[model samples]
Target: MANLDLTLKDMMAVDGAVGAAVVDYDSGMALGHLGGSKALDLQVAAAGNTEVVRAKIRTMEQLRIKEDIEDILISLSTQYHVIRPVSGRKGKGLFLYLALDRGRANLALARHRLRDIEENIEV
Candidate 1:
């Protein structure tokens, strides 16, 4: 596992990857970001998405699901937003957010790739 710079490059290599960011949910700050478009700001997306993760976690707590979130996928006509919260004590309150071109990506493979990235990524 390397650092943010190396991992971000790996993420961008995923098929159809548009952008990727390592974000700290607790602070709404991006540890690093790459490939964001003018129409899609990774920093803004990271901050706003932290709330989405928080709310989901809160809801799960209230519901007593006792399960962890592996990843979240939000799809639109032209794009996909994937939010993956980092697990383990070392990864708590941090996440990787990725954007993809809807027509170009395979969701299942992308999810698997993201998992691999998460597992090997270094802070």
Candidate 2:
């Protein structure tokens, strides 16, 4: 199984990846991070995205939606931000956040790769 550091490295290998982090949504803290440039502070982004995840979860509960979230995508003029909640039993309240250059990323493939990587994580 992949460890946290390896998982973070794998995420950085994705095309156009600008930054990545594993975060705890419950605490708005990053468990690990990589590849943040001057324009992006991954730790700060991770903490901010926790609110997005929490808000979505709350809305889903209010709407009584039984389905789990796959991933939340935010499209920006220059970037694509993907937040994927870990599905492993031990990984509840954790998520993998990825930032990609909009011109170079393939959204579908990145999602697929992230899911595969998440599955391999030992937690």
Candidate 3:
């Protein structure tokens, strides 16, 4: 299984990846991050997205939807943000976040790869 550093490296290899991070949604803090520029701060993104994840889960609970979230996608004019909560036993409360350049990314493939990475990661 890949460690945190390897997981982040694999994420950056995606065609249009501009930034990636492993975050703890419970605490709104990043465990590790890679590839963000001044325009995109990984730490801030991690904290903001924690709220997104929490809100979605909370809403799901209130609606009585028992299924777990597979992933959350945020599409912007220039970028695509993918938030995937890790499903492994060791990864509870953690998530992988990836930002991609819209013009260069293949969203479907990126999602598929992210899923693979998530499954194999060892936290």
Measured by TM-score, the strongest candidate is: 3
User: 1-123 in candidate 1: lDDT tens per residue?
Assistant: 758898899889989999999999999999999998899999899999999999999999999999989999999899999999988666788999999999999889999999998888778
Q: How many Å off is the CA of 116 in candidate 2? A: 0.5
Instruction: After superposing candidate 2 on the true structure, give the runs of residues whose Cα lies further than 4 Å from its correct spot.
Output: none
lDDT of 1 at 13: 91
Q: Provide the lDDT at 49 for model 3.
A: 99
Model 2: which residue pairs collide? none
Summed backbone clashes in each candidate are: 0, 0, 0
When sorted by TM-score, best at the front, the candidate numbers are 3, 2, 1
Q: What is the Å distance of residue 24 in model 2 from its true position?
A: 0.6
C-alpha displacement of 22 in model 1, angstroms? 0.5
Best by lDDT: 3
Query: Deviation in angstroms for 71 in model 2?
Result: 0.1
CA error at residue 6 for candidate 1, angstroms = 1.1
TM-score of 1: 0.96
Which run of 10 residues does model 2 get worst, by summed lDDT?
A: 114-123
lDDT by residue for model 2 over 1-123, one digit each (tens)? 888899999999999999999999989999999999889999899999999999999999999999989999999999999999998887787999999999999989999999998888765
| Candidate 3 C-alpha lDDT tens digits along 1-123 | 999999999999999999999999999999999999999999999999999999999999999999989999999999999999998898989999999999999999999999999999887
